[model samples]
Target: MNILKSFFCAGLMSSTMAATSMVSGSAIAAEVKLRLLETTDIHVHLADYDYYRDKQSDKVGLAKVSSLLKTARSEAKNSMLFDNGDLIQGNPLGDYIAKEKGLKDGEVHPVYKAMNMLNYDAANIGNHEFNYGLDFLKKSIKGANFPYVLSNVYVLDGDKDPSNDKPLYDPYIIINKDVIAEDGSKHMVKVGVIGFTPPQIMQWDKANLEGKLRVEDIIDSANKYVPQMKEKGADIIVAIPHSSVSTSERKGMEENASAYLSKVEGIDAILFGHGHLVFPSKKYEGFPGADVAKGTLNGVPATMPGFWGSHLGVIDLTLSGETGNWKVSDGTGSVRGIYKRDGRKTIPLVEADAAINEAIKHEHEETIAYMRKGVGKTTAPINSYFALVADDPSIQIVTNAQKWYVQKLVNGSEYDGLPVLSAGAPFKAGGRGGPDYFTVVPAGEIALKNVADLYIYPNTLRVVKMTGSEVREWLEMSAGQFNQIKPGMDGEQALINTDFPSYNFDVIDGVTYKIDVSKPARYSKKGEKVSDGHRIVDMMFDGKPVDPKQEFVIATNNYRASGGGNFPGLKGDNIIISAPDENRTILANYIFDQKTINPSADKNWSFAPLSGKAKVSFTSSPSAKDVATSMGFETMGMAENGFAKYRIDLSK
Candidate 1:
């Protein structure tokens, strides 16, 4: 006998046996029971492991999620699984496919080959999907088993049918299924799922999408279509938006598509992604009739599972026959990992499907061979162990490479005399990213795969023209790296903001600067100047005060050039030159160009004088001990207190 609990806003009641017995006496007997399963932001880790580093990543990949999908289907009467995009262009495997295999017309892309095995009902386009040229995207989509949905992106062609000039995916897909009601009767549910990508893709990848296509605001597109979907006999509406809710200064406001689409009259549930965080459940007050926290949007249920195939979002709906609408009865969203790594042995919790695994086995094997192809040689072990506490050789090599690449370009151009500065941040600096995530290059043959591991993103090198004052403001934003200063002296504590994103703390290697956390920060991470006195003090170039009016050429990624870091005066008009080569590629070329390059930490950048200190603790995996100690910091004995603490003299 299977015992199931029936839930409603009123209360929960236990019932024995099948779902058909309870609804015999009701006036309206027919009811629909539909289950929606969603997977979002699976960044191309299809084989269940990170092939670039030759290890298993517990946080991402589809191997772990396969188990959750199996378990979810076993519990549901009628189910449909949908992927919410970002499937292409993230890991080293994605790079291997794009750069090596080269997707030509009629050829199947590796990501699509992996995704086709999953049998997704429908998928949305993510901003990262357009990172490669539009031609590549067109070829990849041709081989997909499912129809790609996009309501916002439009093709521009004169008078002719847009579909004729350019292939456009359908805006929405309506899936019809027979759902078993509690009373043993079957009801048909028309699930209309609409997909939207953020309109900001134009700004992020203007080179690929600007003149060829146009993206409208998310809200405007959803509003125009909700009525149409409803008119088309869609009983339940789900908006699969590849946009994230804002978590900045405004806490609960729905800044993205999920929040904005939930307010639309016909939307019943919202499946969200792109921010890469989990929102199991949330409530938006401004939207009427939608109570998302209770699993209901406008009285409908909504959920966003975490990214990287870590979790499968399950939303269960209880339909009302009298009103002809669905409401969230009860729901739960959770993360599922494939294997549990205790020590040397990894315990397998989920097994990969034989068919799916076997289908891509050849491609998987070839990808490994492609990544291991050697690029150059490294004289010393390059790692990011001390990246957070002090200057690190791993990041230094990247910045050094950027400076080398830009100096040649500047010398060839009219701006040869301008001072060139390299700005780079440590991506894997052992904070939220676990211990093994840190970049550790052995002193030997450095492969292209290893180079990719050091710089994970496919960001292009861009030169931005910034004044010394704007550069000062940019450094001030990075000053958020330190803990708040205390009033009186006399304290011994750690002096770091463990929660600060390591990527935002720009280490400008060519210039010398001291961050005075003793003074308030002049600018917030969002580029807002909160305090009058600048946190960056005594900024010097070649031991001389930097001229406020002097122009400088700064090397950074395309993301920063398009204002990804919220840095002041680094967006739009400030861009001087956009290099076609990726930043990591430039770094690789620089290493090869140098033949034998030695990267050393300058130690030019440091925190301001500490007035008072407080003991702050942080947690790191055991693997970071050796790297941490090499940077001149003492790691206290391990604490069963759930976090690791390192003692540092805050006083300058």
Candidate 2:
């Protein structure tokens, strides 16, 4: 107790008081409402500009959210701001700062420079923070003016007891601060903040964090620390679990275990992210133990702000009773967005904080110039607006690049004679990311930005060896992106399942198959087998039925090869070559080498004709109308949130 007290007393300062001490015997007359503001999954969007499209966007960026911060803080009597994580690596600007111009000693990272200006109280370390490796992560966080707390992840020091293992960062921190009650009386309070990242980081970033670090389950870590914090004189405990909310039986180390974490004792408030969905919304209305109306999980106040700075989460707690016996009497949670849409018009709810944009102006300009450098020319237009509904040229070009690069590396190796296949998915098909998020590159000169738009993630190349039967299972898993359609039904059925992310809909280029949506999905969203339904029909390789026993090489990214998206039959052991170069870089190189390339879909895959009167419809960008018409589809008119609805007559 003395050691913990000494550490907090050494460097802690209250938000309102110059010098404050832990309240041992202070009395308060009335209740105090403390506002807890959170921004999660910022993903280094410091500016309100899209680096891929190279245009101004009013929908995203922390600069826009920063304006909401000032308003939110001004409305509350007492408040604290914290970021739930995913702060360092999402957009091209972040890539420029980390890869092009590296962070050095005495240099502040651009994201941190902007965040520091907002006066953040503290932050959590999200799972994406480990994508660039440990040294880079360490260097990036050093520039932050505020502290970081991560309770679950730790260094492997070969200790007999896990509790004694050294944490990669502070497990928790107790901030002693003075607060003003409604009666205008001042009282000191101890607020303990603890954070947890998903345990799957071990699998997601295995190459960078294999033997160096280990992560524990979120509930276990919270159980271990919350009691200790209370014993160490913490009046209120706030948990920032960077995982999402799930209402499932606690099986340990499960991703999206925030609901289970809420059942932990002594936690007053919860702020979670990583699912990139808003809390208290209709999305989780029937989820067990989750009160969508009250914005809580297991009756504890909680919220998850949308990703990429689209929204801000706020939790207000009414604290009552005396200083030593203070408790939360009432609690509420809500989210505020930076923009809203009415029909086709997007209305900006807040302006970008000019200070934040100014802080990173030089880096932002460099990133724009870096992306605008010409790489090659494209003979046909490329866009992802129709990628999910049909075979798309945008995805075809990426798979071609992957197969081209992988063939060169395995020419004389042990896997030379095996058939090579490439897997690619539409990353920007615009579900939760909004209508303008899809890729669109015109038929003309191509630049580095075009390649980046084609393949958004920073995943490195990896080749996995699998049998022909295993490939079938892989396709079946990817087929979960579609919902089962009934035959001979009336009215319209949704063609695309919004719950399944478009990035996980991997299409293998070397095989030809048709998706039968009338059949039920064989795998669940978590990649577990739920039924024996077969969706992939006429599975052919080399103009014949694929042999189940034949072996083949699959060119893919590290995330898929290492069990990301929970795909079937992947656990990192089957990888034949783990290339360190990013897929986007390989794509850029492939385009440059060709000088002039034709991006045309080979029509390798399509949906099997459905015999029914029911119309199949899907929503996409309003700009996709011309392409949809060219493919013999008709626009069904506008859908909600500015998305244009289109119908596909499957009987054709």
Candidate 3:
């Protein structure tokens, strides 16, 4: 039996209510059950195996999710499958396909291969799809039989934002699927599927998108196309937006705008992503019109399938229609988890689907071989266990590469001779990825797999001009990683704020500062001024107090430079150079050029000295036990969940 649970709030109608809504006899319109299945942020996991670890992992893979798809489809009479973007690039396999295997003019990427074999009805373009440039994206999707809808982006008429004059892709697809009613009679159901991706793609992918395209705001595009879908005789409209409901404001051109998108007049349901979070979760509590218990926003049913094929987003709509038209009577949303993550262990629900594994068999084999090749050697062990506690090498190498690349890229340009800074973050630190997820590359010859472990995302390098004050705000946002604590009253206060993602804890190189955790955060992750105290103190550049007006070039990934984490004063307009190189490739080149890369992290930032004795605790991999003290932390022995708890004596 499917472990299906309803996320309906009290007084909200459910499947039980749908059964009671039908009229008594022939006076009843036809009641059709439509199952809309969505897979999002798959990130090129076509199989159940981790190409880097060379082991089977239950936590990912579309093949394992394919089993869930078949089961989900079997439970309903009429079903439609969709991919909510971010499918083309993410893992070592995706990197291998892009760097080694290479895409020919008409060849299909393995991601599209698996997506096509799964019979995706329609898919949207994800921001990462633009990582390899437009030609690559255009060529990669050639093998897909289904249409890829992108409502917001447009072909530029003369170098401006998306206009009504031209759309880059098909705005929507009206699928004329034959529906079978409870009476065993079949009728045509005009189901409209419209897709919206982040309009910030124009900024995040400025290198590839500048002169070629302009992406309109998602809410604006939805307001325009949703009505068109209705006028085109669509019975039901399902929006597959590669965006999420992440911000506090329910309106704006915010990266995650699914909540407002759902409020549009004609949209019946929405699938949101790119934040890699599970919706209908407790994280969305207190938002007006957002019923976490009901998996809805503004009364429109929605769901976000977890990333890496972890779960399948399912929305069931009970439609009762007249001979020529249909209206949604009852609707509900739920997600099916293919694996159960318990601490360090994962339990798979089903085996990998045979057809999907067979579909990308060759690419998988090649990717494995590519990841194992030695890139260069490291002078010392590189691990991220101490990332939050101290400056870490895993982040240092990436920043060093960015700084190196950007310094050279801006050498002869109009912004020459300006001091360069780089923002670095621990990507593989133990957070949502679990304790064992921290990067641990032993001192030796580093392989492509280790490089992937060091830098996980496929973000490209960028250089943005930032004022000293804006730079302080950037560090202030990164300093939000800590939990506020009084000097003498703490007992086992968590060192890191669990809610703040490790990815956004950026350490700004080429400067020095102190984070005073006793003070409330200057700004929350949502850019809200929840408190007024500034945690970033003694922020300096070049041995002098940072001048608020002084301009400095900071090398950063496209995500941060394009206001990805919502950092202040950072956006496309400030960008001076948008390199077409991925950070991983830049790191590989830097290592290869140096031959013996030293894993050294500059102690640029540290916690402020407290007035009295205070203590805090954090969890790290058990492997960090032997080296905990040398890193200035006292191990409190292993916890029951297999993590090593360490205590920080702030008095030191």
Among these predictions, the greatest lDDT belongs to 2
Candidate 1 runs further than 4 Å off: 1-28, 57-59, 157-168, 247-257, 281-300, 322-348, 487-500, 614-619, 637-643
Candidate 3 on 399-422: residue-level lDDT in tens?
A: 888888888888888889888999
Best candidate, TM-score: 2
lDDT of 2 at 597: 88
Ranking of models by lDDT: 2, 3, 1
Q: Which window of 10 residues has the lowest lDDT sum in candidate 2?
A: 15-24
> What lDDT would each prediction earn against the true structure?
0.71, 0.89, 0.82
Residue-wise lDDT of candidate 1 within 1-652, one digit each (tens)? Answer: 1233324422332233232333433234445566778888877777676765776555566756766787888887778778888887888777777777777777777677767766677888888888887777777789898878888888877565655443256788787756677656555667788888877777677667767887777777788777898888787787888987643432231225565566678777677888666554332344444454555544446666766676677777666663245443444333344544455334667666555556667777888887787778888888776676577788889999999999989996978899999999888766533445678788888887778878888889999888888888888888777666663545543456764678888888788888776677677665777888877888999899989988899998887778776677866678888899999999889877777767677887876555545333344545666765765556775533223556545454
Which parts of model 3 are misplaced by more than 4 Å? 1-28, 159-164, 282-287, 292-294, 404-420, 464-470, 490-492, 526-533, 540-553, 572-580, 627-629, 634-646
| Candidate 1: count of backbone clashes, pairs at least 3 residues apart or interchain | 11
Model 1 global lDDT (CA atoms, 0 to 1): 0.71
Per-model TM-score versus the true fold: 0.86, 0.95, 0.88
All models, RMSD in angstroms: 6.2, 6.8, 7.1
Candidate 2 vs 3: which has more TM-score = 2
